[model samples]
Target chain A: MKCPKVLLLAAGLTIFASVDSVAGDVKVIANASVKADTISAADLKRVFLEEKSSLDGSHVEPLLEKEGRAHEAFLQEYLGMSEDDLQSYYQTLLFTGRGFMPKVLGSDAEVVAYVARTQGAIGYVSSAASAEGVKTLAIGVPSSNAERKLITRVEPDYPDTLKRLNIGGTVRLRVSISAKGNVEDVELLGGNPILGESAAAAVKKWVYAAGRSRTIAEVSILFDGR
Target chain B: MSTSVTDKLRVGAQLYDRNLGQLGQYHPSLDWAVADYRFKSWFGVRGGKVKTTLGLYNDTQDLDFLRTFALLPQSVYPTDLRDATIAHLGGDVYGSLSLKHRLGGLAYTAYAGHRSDSIYGGVAYLAAQYQVYFSSYGGLQYGGDLRWNTPLKGLLIGISRMNEDVTGKAKAINPLNPGAGFVPYSAISKADWADQFYGEYTAGKLRIDSEYRRFVHDEQDQTADIVLVEIYDDVRGWYVSGSYRVTKRLALGYYYSRYSVTSVAGGLLAPYAPHQTDTSLPANHVYDKVISARVDLRRCWNVKVEGHFMNGYEYSSYPNGFYPQVNPQGFKPNTNALVVKTGFNF
Candidate 1:
């Protein structure tokens, strides 16, 4: 009986260790000169994809680790692409003359070093890696926790015809929250246009937590006809 | 060379091979050398030699690595007139407007300038079209393009318009007297206006592209004393293409293209009969069906094999001039050819 319990504990410990190793944390780091301390995942993807070159009104550059655990995680989690697909995507951009290949380093140490010396450079590294000279950025959750809290909630009314037909989708919106927590504006980013209209109207009526200045937030609302 | 002076200011010079291994000397020339300043996401100004935004693929036709097919549909991007349609020397105003929410985006470009004629290719193509030997001087070219990237991923719709005024000197040879020197035939001027509409949809591994184009060419032939021929030629072309990405390294594509030119007086000629003296023969229309398979050998290299089944002949020739024997009864013939091409880019 004791031997069986010992075996069970050993198995539990091994599973925990494997989980820890596979779910290793990643940290987004930037040069010391960068003004922003937090970034949204969508913005991070956009920056790395070369869709936008500026962040919070400051010019910025994105660096990639050549190959490693952190590199794989960044590509999979943030960019939603495999390494090969990412390379092909970059090649397409280069051939189209829309963008250039970003600087790539071999290791986390090299990435950290490059980001430290280069102003406005952004990169990702393993959370355990030493980031002595760079600033680490926190991923912002637009509509939850410490970032912004929903005080007043307004549910969008599903269209009657759409409900009857079982038409449903997720509508993404960019909401502007004023310093006083009032919803200032809402713009539809994507979804069925008709559904987007109702979503925007409901988002405009919602209230957020007060902050020092206006903050832009991305939120998604799903309608499943229920 | 491209340098980003600031977050919103960029200057660059783009150069591309003039012939893409299809014609004479392989020389690289400037496609666009420009300074662009962006005031906002919706507005920008660019000045210099700019890529003419005349068609769906014209702006990036030279970028072989970005295209799936080894060769673009020749009915629209005819291999011979590449230089004339590549870029224009002047300024342009371009911008992108993000539609409400993330519904989609609309990009637009408008420009005006003169295009330099390639002595070997562009001039030759023009000469063949008018059925006379000619030396060309480049002319004014201007156009605008608007593309809407729909909310549906990988779907795009666009429309473009272009106008060109080309001028050249034509000379005719007397076929009956083979030994005599050529005579000054007419000073030819051609005004070509074209419009095109295109749509592309890409979903996962499947891709579809289609385009329709129409061109109107008005020509005036004149000597020092009198005008000889004044006519309008209408040409229409369209293509439907689809591709499937079978794997990470391989893709297959097929396309059907058709080109037709209206029977015009300039394209007609008198029959050999003594009683017949009016322009009567009609020019032939052309059709091409192509199938292609491409394999990416590595990150930087790709090879493509393509087969083209072609029908019809382009049968416009000078009056009383030498005619080729391919079309004996004025009926177009069918031909087939295979092409293999590889591309490497860094």
Candidate 2:
């Protein structure tokens, strides 16, 4: 091939690789117990952000990834806010001393480490990542019956510090609850380190007694300093 | 300092029914009221307002064997040491001056406040201090606060230090009198003291705080130096914070600290007393780490809950007596706390 043609082919191949990466689905994971049952998409949102403090009466903690492509996808798909909007919301919270974002880890390995070490921790990873310590939470389609069930029983608020500080704004998270009512694991779908703890602490104490196995839920925090 | 004539003042009162008398004495619920006045830069006063409280104040946290009496969750309380307990039934005075003229870009404020508590005591507190705040980013941001009391921010990192310091008489039995030695001891009339006198400056996301404090008698003295470096990153709605402390949970939130003290003659007290005492002249080196995480959640009803954890060394001494006494070895107990309070201001 001519040198010019060769250069164009190389450029085309690079573009293809980039497209392949973009099209890949970001995998959200949970503890082994989460896969044992199915949860509604709305419930998944509640679990991660701790809108619902408990499933049943047990408390659980949710986890999430630091800002990245996966985080943005999780937020867009699971949460309704964009990355810039979420950042702005968190900034307001920090100044008011309402609460801090959740702890951020660099990789899925780190997320796994956090979930394994903390009692009620949750996290997400690329489906291709290792599942050494965490389990997978089955996310039911929103329109499905399970999703409907999860929605009706939605927790109205997170039992975390952000709630204490009256922090508002939506964060998407994945949660794992144990039979004993403890948040077994967590994964951040979207949010910062400061506001993350409030969600995580509340989730760890959540209880979901009537679920078909363990469940995952998503939620949002709306701050009104009144 | 010059005094300005201002009769009308902002006033508020708090009344509590002490159903469970924490003092172990059958006492009724107490009532306290505070009224403060502000001058419009007439005379030497150039600030917005001066605040002062006058009423019966309870210093139960400083009572004899206070650690044993404190109803705090075990997580927040440290080793049980007996410190002097003084409840001021007199006055709590505060005054601040604004310096918007001196520095055009920053608004400087200087304040001095005093609280005198006396409970079955000869003398309680004559605490006094001077502090300034620079509103560098206009009035939207604040950067400095210096005071003789605990740091007063609503967050854990600010208020965790000296959370409980009841200024009064010592509770140790007199080592000289064997028979008079088993009861809570009282301080010599002139031995009352104050601590945590520090200056702090913060601009944007950084804060520098330092203090050199002393507890003294007419002839003897005990002193300490504390310094802290905190770099706060503000991310709009949420914050990520880390700090290094020179003291235990007493200084700030999740403070990893090391402390040293020098004393010619000073005693350790309980609850708020330093855990370590240096009697041989004036020097000791102590070091430790503090890990703190704080979150302020504003939900329905304006509720604020703060949690703090400190794993490090504290210097506590009950230099006065042995009765209402505390053990120094058990003085610096590991401290953890979760405080939930509902508050509002207009």
Candidate 3:
């Protein structure tokens, strides 16, 4: 069978576009004191948010660009937060004694120079910037729908009594998955409560494609009886 | 001002005016000062005058830029009572712990300290109105707070409890014999404690929060011989609030607050009612409804406006912002307040 020309061209462009964007946008840089040369997006978010202070047995700090294209891309791709929201979050942390403001720099050159000189510092700059005297870290695939491809599924068992009684409908659930791809929790979104519980029990045994961060997915199971 | 002394240690101090000279002109007072050191995720220590973490907003109340409302729920966090419970002199042990199997994480704090009241605060303002001049007001204090960040995406819940051994001295009307206009008096609290529980949920641009708090104080008074005087008080407050980020530049919020108190007094001068020795009148509570709007003028500047509709006034030494002393002419069943605040950060 031959693929359509338009479909082939579209697929090619999609691949090229993804590669281009990922390769040319932002580069994660770290100081000499940092032991890891590759960082998961999950850990990056945690460090930047002040939720975690160390990475791979070494103390670490996050430096941010005040404002720029690289800053915007990093915020959206890894942190999934707006600059405004990030600022408010920092303000809350400072006043609560949980965290203080991290160092912020002006441009890609400034970030590169500072990361190269400051111990335990981790920062990001445009891919075009020179990364002399610093380590570049590769980020894992970002969390998205692609990360939740089902690997193993447990079929829900319908109670014989309900099936005999012709009680049938679709049970909807909101599922929480851990970073390592196992189901962490499940709660009923909509459906019969009894069916929801049975469905949740089965979903808890499901597994997904491993990802760098936690993710929430919606699932539905159907029961039919005549 | 706050700065990190090292990677693991930080120090800071804050100063503020209770009210912008509305209740009365007053000198600035220290809000909090402390040095914090974190050794790990499960153990850390703080020393000096440390801030108290009672509810969702207690420690962050002064940071106006962090919230959508100009005035928080007064029933739970009264502006006038800021000095009495904001912080204590001593130390605290605090940390955050992660649990296995996606159970989420726990953050906790425990502290023991000395309570010190300021004459320039709302407590003194109310005392003056009652003709009770306090020469001293303070004592031992201790508390703890625990919060859980559950596996559920954006939900958090917490509980806090604090106990104080309160002592105070003043010149006031003798409770043993009401005929004697003024005399020296002293108070030693047998039980003074506060308990609070709070929860918050955030989904995208919308946030919802709720908290409930209860305070109890039982005191023994020092007066003329052969006369025994004691005081008992119970106060309760709670509020539920919601806010949304309507756009990049605008936000809106609303909250309902309820405050109430019950009390009994003895030979010492009365702090609330003029003629009654014990009371639980409906006027001892305040129920408030509020609506607010916030606008971000710039990345570092924002303005907040809010309106409050209250049904009653707290009529005791509780020192909630709405004090009976501030309103000598008397209080109506309903009151309204409008607030507008702006901030600039660099």
Best-fitting candidate, scored by DockQ: 3
Chain A TM-score of candidate 3 vs. true chain A: 0.53
Off by over 4 Å in 3: A1-27, A37-42, A95-98, A127-130, A138-226, B20-24, B173-183, B224-228, B266-281
How do the residues B1-346 of candidate 1 rate in per-residue lDDT, one tens digit apiece? 6767776677777666655332436656665777777665456877787777766788777667665687778767766567767777787887775575557778888888887756555445435433556665467888899999898877999999988886656665533343575656554447788999999987767889999988776666654445555656666788999988899889999999877665344422223212212222223455789999989998689999999887765444211111243234544466676989998877
Q: Which parts of model 2 have CA positions greater than 4 angstroms off? A: A1-226, B1-8, B15-32, B41-186, B189-258, B266-288, B300-316, B319-346
Per-model fnat list? 0.09, 0.00, 0.28
lDDT tens digits, residue span A1-226, model 2: 1111101101101100001011123445555433323344545555554333233233334566776766777776765455533443343322222112445677778887777666445566654345467654434432221321221122233334544565433333455544343446765544434544554554455454444444444432222222
How much lDDT does each candidate structure score? 0.67, 0.32, 0.75
- Stretch of 10 with least lDDT, candidate 1 chain B: B272-281
Error of 3 at A149 (Å): 25
lDDT minimum window of 10 residues, candidate 1 chain A: A11-20
* TM-score (all chains, Cα) for each model: 0.70, 0.29, 0.75
Model 1: per-residue lDDT, tens digit, A1-226?
Answer: 0111111101101100001011124668899888876676656876897655666767688999998878988886787676766886776545444456788999989999999999889999965566779987655432332466677876777777877776655555666778898889777755567877887887788887787777666555556543
DockQ of each: 0.15, 0.01, 0.26
- The TM-score obtained for chain B of candidate 1 when compared with the true chain B: 0.83
The residue pairs in collision within model 3 are: B175-B267, B175-B268
What local lDDT score does residue B142 receive in model 2, on the 0 to 100 scale? 12
